[model samples]
Target: MKFLPVGYNTQDLEKQAKNKWRWQWLSECDSKGMKWTDWLKKIDVCGVAYCTFCGKTINYKSNGKKALKLHCEDGNHQKIANVVKTNSVSSILAI
Candidate 1:
C-alpha cells in the first residue's frame, strides 16, 4: 500500500482539524475481533499513536480504526509483530 504522511493533502488537514483523538480506539478490538493493545500505544498527541512492534508513530486523525487496521496489515508491521510474538513465546518457554 502507498504510504502517505499525515497532512499530505488538503483532505487530511481538514480531517485532522475536525477530529480529536479517542482513547477508546486503543482498547477496542478490530472488526476481526482482535485487539492490538499489546503493541499499540496512545501518545500524548491528539491523533497520533505509537506502534511498539514497528517503533513508529501513526497518524489516524482522519481514518481512525481503518487507519490502524491498515498499519497492522502492512507487510513490515506484520513481519515485525510476528517476529516479536515468536520471540516472546520462545523466551517464555525457556524460562
Candidate 2:
C-alpha cells in the first residue's frame, strides 16, 4: 500500500495536506466502514488557550485533547480573539 504524497515521518510530525493516494486510501477505508485508528493520528493545536473570536479564555479543560471549532461574529465586529466558555458546552466532542 503505497500512499502517494506520503512521507516517511516520525510520530511528532504530521502531513500538512493530503496527497492523491493517501486521499484514495482514506476514501477506501471510509467505504469499507473501517474505524480510523491506524490510518490517522491525533493532532493538537498546541497551547491555544485564547479564543480567536472574543479575546478571552474559556477555561477549556479536556479529558483528552479535543478539536476546536470557532465561530465568528457579524460582518463588522471586533478583530480581537476571545475564548469564553458558555453553558452549552459538553464533555465529548462529536468528531
Candidate 3:
C-alpha cells in the first residue's frame, strides 16, 4: 500500500480509486451472503479490529472487508485460528 508524498492531488485520486475497488469487493461479498458489517462487528471489539488468527491490525477504511476475507482464507490464519480454538477448549477442560 504505497502512496505518493503528501500535498499531491494525485495521492488523493489514488486513494479514491482504492476506496472504490474496496467498496466493489465488499459489494461482491454481500451478494455472496457475506455481510461486511456483521464481520466487522464480530472482530471490531473495543474500537480496534484485528485478525484474531494472524494479529494483523485491520485498516477497514482503506481495505474494507476484503482484508478480513483474505485473512480468513490465509493458510497461516486458518492454522492459528485452529490453534486458538484448540487452546480455548483445552483451557476449558483444564478448568
Global lDDT of each candidate? 0.66, 0.26, 0.44
Which residue runs does candidate 2 get wrong by more than 4 Å?
1-48, 63-67, 70-95
lDDT of 3 by residue, 1-89 (tens): 33222232333333533332222332333333433432332221211244434646555445655566765666775665556556877
- Number of clashing residue pairs, candidate 1: 0
- CA lDDT of 4 in candidate 2? 22
- Predicted structure 2: clash tally: 7
Provide backbone clash counts, one per model: 0, 7, 0
Clash pairs, model 3 backbone: none
Question: Which one wins on lDDT?
Answer: 1
Clashing pairs in 2: 52-81, 53-82, 54-82, 55-81, 55-82, 56-82, 56-83
Give me the candidate number with maximum TM-score. Answer: 1
Superior by TM-score: candidate 1 or candidate 2: 1
Q: Please identify model 1 stretches exceeding 4 Å from their true place.
A: 1-17, 28-34, 91-95
Q: Against the hidden reference, what TM-scores do the models get? A: 0.65, 0.18, 0.42
Model 1: how far residue 79 lies from native, Å: 0.3
Q: What is the C-alpha RMSD of each candidate to the true structure, in Å?
A: 8.4, 15.9, 10.5
Candidate order by decreasing lDDT = 1, 3, 2
